[model samples]
Target: MKCKILPPKVLYHPVLPYKQLTSDNTHKLLFGLCRTCMNKISFKCKHIDDPTLNKHDKIHEIKRCKECKNIKNEKCIHSNEERVIVGTWSTIEIDKAIEKGYKLQKIYELEHFEKTSTDIFKLYVDTFMKYKQEASGCKCDPKYCKPDCENDKECKTKIQYIIDNAAYNLDIDKVKHNSGLRFIAKICLNNLWGHFGMRDNFTQKEYCFTLEHITKIVFNEKYKDISTMILDENIVLTEYKEKEEYSKPNPSVNVYIALFTTAHARLKLYELLDILQERVLYMDTDSCIYNDDGSEACKK
Candidate 1:
């Protein structure tokens, strides 16, 4: 979703909506979904600790609990605690939650969300697809070849073919069972977002052998959270992170891409869960377990 947020008045967090699913024993069929949704929502208040604040302003205020000193109580929403949801939720789901006394409060209308294409994973997906296609070319029959097919170049085995064409961490047994291809496909499908969203300011390490080097690292104005370990009388190990201003931007890191990818995926899973409803038995990031009573819900 595209919308402007007034800073200080609005805070954002990256979270998947599927994580909010209940862990009770009411779930049923095991099914998988793949897709996404993008949204930005603002909610009004539900439970407030203070009784004197104006109603409209109180809606935006989060209350810390007296007993737990937290804004939320997972086991139950106490009379004194209050919070506003910070992620996506469907209109139907919100209504049901409110009907069941869930702390949904009031959800504002979303502006708009739509799909567009990009070349983010084009190279990786295309390369693997080509490798998979070429690997499937060998007929595995000597009769099909004119001279008994002994040359690895002419009739390459799947392992030799992939190893020569792709730099994959292949499992030999799984390759025999054709699962290696699936594993590689899964990595291509999922790991791209993680790579694109990797944190840029990760802790960096330096090994120092002299007091000057140690002092130089410890006193660097561009770094923070300096930690040191004396390896010996002459050796020291130091770890620290570059200050935000000094940190370099990662060329591949685009948090918006990562967020939208997972958001769409959660919406896809939610669609299936809506169909399964009371039959859903278990839940995972991209899949679910539920009951199948010959109703052919899976056909949907």
Candidate 2:
């Protein structure tokens, strides 16, 4: 079914102290002893000012100290890198583990599995809990909910009203599966990045190309001689361009190549190998060497 892609939501930074707290302004730090760990936690002057300090003392109450909150944020960001490195296990792992039930959890629990920082662990657990709750049709407790909770009847009603309006305005099913949705999202996201002039942590287009061009490149017979082109260990051409560029090229036919460094290329090669499996019968380290026949090589 044909689907119309919706415009992507403008990417915005979460409200942060770096943005909210202006430079050159002295913020009073309020110290508090943690009730549980007895560890000292400092809150920012704006949110947690010392009560003993005079009202006109120009003290700002901080919500949370940089030590507690900022470190947590940093660790959470680092956890993403760790997750990527620890490749996801297939369902087969879980299925096999199920045979032993809680014994598997016990064994793995005792083994010194690489531990993430507490803050990162909490963030992952919270996210998993949220998704589990959502999938199971369970409501999160207000006490445990994130700060952006709409608990009051009016706020809740407003949220539902907005959701209902959005549901009425857009085709939800089509939005979920639309092929052009990612392209539209990329354009919108890049536009937002340009508009806001945010350099770091914001979305950027690494590669952009039409589906027709991608399909042609993937299925093209002209690249069959690519195997002979790879000559040495250090040099492997991951890309190839036709000797003759197309005449009367379609506007959407241009290819924006994303070249990977040597290290990344090795990792990508392995990843592609895993995905292709048995279909990829033979893959020489430097080239795509097929065992079928030398006749196909001469044809190109």
Candidate 3:
């Protein structure tokens, strides 16, 4: 037999066409689609320790983050602890939410009880990540005592684990958190919400050169932390009464105002359209259109 190749007079895939993505198929779409876009940068990054940031670096161009395997170099990218996602839903989905015993409520940016200088972002994330005992040098292994171990929750090893975790507090010397944990805590405390308040989107668009700059200048001069070297600062709410307008606005107390304000604005837009009260077909974190006109959604 001679080698040969023949072109089909008519050619097409014989496989069954996939399900048409509709308001009812969100779960399937999420599972089937690759979320490569998640890695692309849409916002800026801010530094936690350096209040002396540059205004020019604020509006830098978009690039993919380190989390994206496809990104090149990836060295200049900055990552953060928490992010705010603003979403929208179609009217039918809004109706479904009511059928499922849910109603949208006003979402507020997180406010903590700690003073703005306290780095609450770090405090909570550290506690929540269960990093307390890992850096204590106690040499205890979690595999030795899982939470669901045969021993009652009061085993001696577990007791030692508890004591080991309680040995250090960031606020005190004797009681300590793991040193590595503390390092992570420091990053989160400083950068999490601060990223939101920044004015530049090049990396993190913090409100640079504003009253925050003044606060850092003042606090770094007056403060003393024997255990930590935080560049403690103020978030003044008093009106800027200066004869000259500030080069940038003064910061609200340690606020990621951009983060929360953007979210609130999204909610306000959703409400203005009365999206929930009407018949909607879908919902997405930021956008919900009546139809998906993409190739997959249009597949026969």
Candidate 4:
């Protein structure tokens, strides 16, 4: 099916504004407030401002981060630092909380987790919109007109040579008839969404026989999450997770894209349900089951 709707280029942070929803304010927000907490746990160093501290080599540890603990300070520096686990909330939530007279204490501890105003998906939207316009016709530019263009005959015939030849003009009829083509197209669509939302870190396994190899992995300050299993006296299997900085994040994994894709899908689904009303018996992400009362409902 052809889709013309596109989601916003920028979006608020994924977290909901409130924890729970009630009948008094069911429609206060677009979606219901998240019932569960999505707090991200992170470690900060006390000597972050210290000029002598190796800021680049800060390692997160369980009780006390390794970098600050090793330093011989006059006082227990780590104890004085506000080592806090803060919840990442959307700007709307923060503002609402403040408006409701909830005093935000320790405001200095807050850090910007993500950019609120960035054209991160601008290139992606521009590329797709360009193709859409070319496959149709530019409102001002007539030289690149296509057969599917809603422009005049003069403009349509201008680019008649590449009407069906261009890569943008996909043969939907061929794909619909051919099972292989349909499968490939479906997989490609799903892969695009999944690829963008791919997880960055995964626990990796390492098998070592030497004490040096085992010690190197076990005592590495960079890897905060580590576990080891002694298969035998000579064999040791180590599973460890690399810190965010050390981890290789997927270049294309943008949460904004994935969120928009799903958001648009949900909106489309809701549109259909609104039309069907009580007829909608069941529905899923990509499938719908509604009662057809021998009318234009099914035809539509």
- Best model per TM-score: 1
Q: In lDDT terms, which candidate is top?
A: 1
- TM of each candidate vs. truth: 0.50, 0.15, 0.18, 0.42
Q: Is candidate 1 or candidate 4 better by lDDT?
A: 1
The C-alpha RMSD in Å for every predicted model, in order, reads: 14.4, 31.8, 25.2, 19.5
Error of 2 at 295 (Å): 76
- Candidate 3 CA-lDDT value: 0.36
Which lDDT tens digits does candidate 3 get at residues 1-300?
A: 111111111212110111223322332322111122222322233322244545444223112223333342233223221111223433333343344333344333433445444353555656633444333323335446443332443444544565555633322222232466656755665565566576521211123245665455345432332122223353332212222222335444334444444445445444423433233355454565444344333332
lDDT for position 204 in model 3:
16
Candidate 2 has its poorest 10 consecutive residues by lDDT at 11-20
Name the regions of candidate 3 deviating beyond 4 angstroms: 1-156, 159-190, 198-300
3 against 4, candidate with superior TM-score: 4
Clashes of each: 19, 12, 31, 0
For 1-300, candidate 2 gives per-residue lDDT tens digits of 111111112211110011111234444221111111111222223434466866555333333345445533342222222211111122233232233221221121111236523353355434433333222211335345433445545545544554464423332222222224444544553343243332222111112144454445546665432222233543433344433332233332212111112223344454444344344565543455333444433234
Residue 57 in model 1: lDDT: 59
lDDT tens digits, residue span 134-252, model 4: 43332324344333443455544544534455545432221112334445545655776898878889788999999999899989988968999999999999999999888877798
Candidate 4 regions exceeding 4 Å error are 1-181, 231-234, 245-248, 293-300
| Cα-based RMSD of candidate 3 | 25.2
Model 1 lDDT tens row, 85-197:
34454444344334434443344555344865676567876666554543333445434543334344555474466546655543333333234564676667567778877
lDDT for each candidate structure: 0.53, 0.32, 0.36, 0.50
In model 1, the number of clashes is: 19
